[model samples]
Target: RLPVRVDVPVEELTRDDGLFLVGTPRGVLRARNVVLASGSLNCPKRPPASADLPATLRQLDSSAYRNAAELEQGAVLVVGSGQSGGQIAADLALAGRPVFLATSRAGRLVRHYRGSDIFNWMTLSGYLDVPRREIVLPSGKLPPRGLLGATHTISLQSLSAQGVVLLGRFMGIENDSLIFGDNLDEHMRFADESSADVKRFIDDYIRRARLNAPPAEDDPAEMIAPRLPSPPIHSIELATSGIRSVIWCTAFRGDFPY
Candidate 1:
């Protein structure tokens, strides 16, 4: 049987010969090998604009954010377009709050294409098993993850249609005004192109494999279409715009105590 320790904080780890000594709150422990699973989402990131916010305003990283009910009275500025930011912005806007979503160019995928889930299509296409060595970028960086939902795809486009103000990537805050980049059109185009590419891949895979997939339907078009245009906002005066809170969901990093 393997022994396990829980609720102990690891303070230090040192290697001697081929073994590792771990210092913990309880005591020192010895191990032949150590596997660090610190987790990717342990530390949430905040934007630079968050640093100079007034004391009166509330700020919550996406990890600390629960729901619109948890926020104080006033509008909210969600400073990312990733899954967390997209979902949270939709949630707040649906709850009748004036929500502004600062978007980055993130890929979008359909929840269900034809009669299959997008994940199933991904698996069938062998996209999930792509080797890192074969596809590694020159910069050694992976591509940004696409926004997907298990139940149903949460479309930023749909969120825009639902009264959520979509802005370009946040630049920084200048005095009382928040500045944003002028790449909103480019971001929207990228999302649309990425989604089309995915759909095309799926269609080709079905044809090549001779899979008996359902015929094309209009639902896909209706679902992917943006009902409203993304707002062309360069900057907004935070105080005058009635925004009282900011939620930064830029990225997550692993936090290793030792």
Candidate 2:
């Protein structure tokens, strides 16, 4: 696929009496046999755990990442790439903001070499039925999870090629300046280089877990990425400290959606 864009309003999920996993306007997307293969919640968000960092980092920015014009440039940081992060990064680049995008999980490879859309590998591989933790279990070796679904990993190379800096997950934020885990770059580069390896890792991990294989022979990724420096953080002193606006693109957790 060559990245053809689509225009469908999700609101079409609300026209029926059926139970809604999500209540979109179209109608309830009902399932007689509901299974949560990836029991993740909505996007994870930041919390007010420090002093000096603006309280702003802890809440949802009404405009999302695309309208980052209100943010100051030079050191802008974007936290996730699920659709929102990608759009935000694209908007920042178009707006010419010195942007930085970061995420812990490298995304899936689009099916076509040109990135039209991800390989329907998740649905294709039947992972939708596997327990979610198969990807995280120490003794398990599933696909690297780079193939689950469409991720925002919104163009790591594109960001760099276009001059947008990228980072790893947000450990915390420093006074106006953000503090990230130390291995941000290394972790990211590894994800970027071998998405294929990540996929293999995830595949094996799940199989092992399903078969109750012992830890002695779990097949981790053949390509071992240099582990990120245990802790990654971005620290900038508040006021004129380069990063004027911090866009937290981290994910949201799954709630009952009541």
Q: So what's the TM-score on candidate 1?
A: 0.86
Give a tens-digit lDDT track for model 2, residues 31-104. Answer: 44443444555445554543345754433441354365566436566766544565666677777877666655
CA lDDT scores, all candidates in order: 0.80, 0.50
TM-score of each: 0.86, 0.52
Task: Put down candidate 1 lDDT per residue, 19-123, tens digits, no spaces.
Answer: 899999888888898988777668886766678877777988988988899999889999887677878887898799999888887877777888988889989
Alpha carbon RMSD to native, model 1: 2.8
The residue ranges of model 1 lying beyond 4 angstroms of the native Cα positions read: 6-9, 16-18, 131-140, 218-231
lDDT for residue 226 in candidate 1, whole number 0-100: 60
Q: After superposition, how far is residue 145 of candidate 1 from its true place, in Å?
A: 1.9
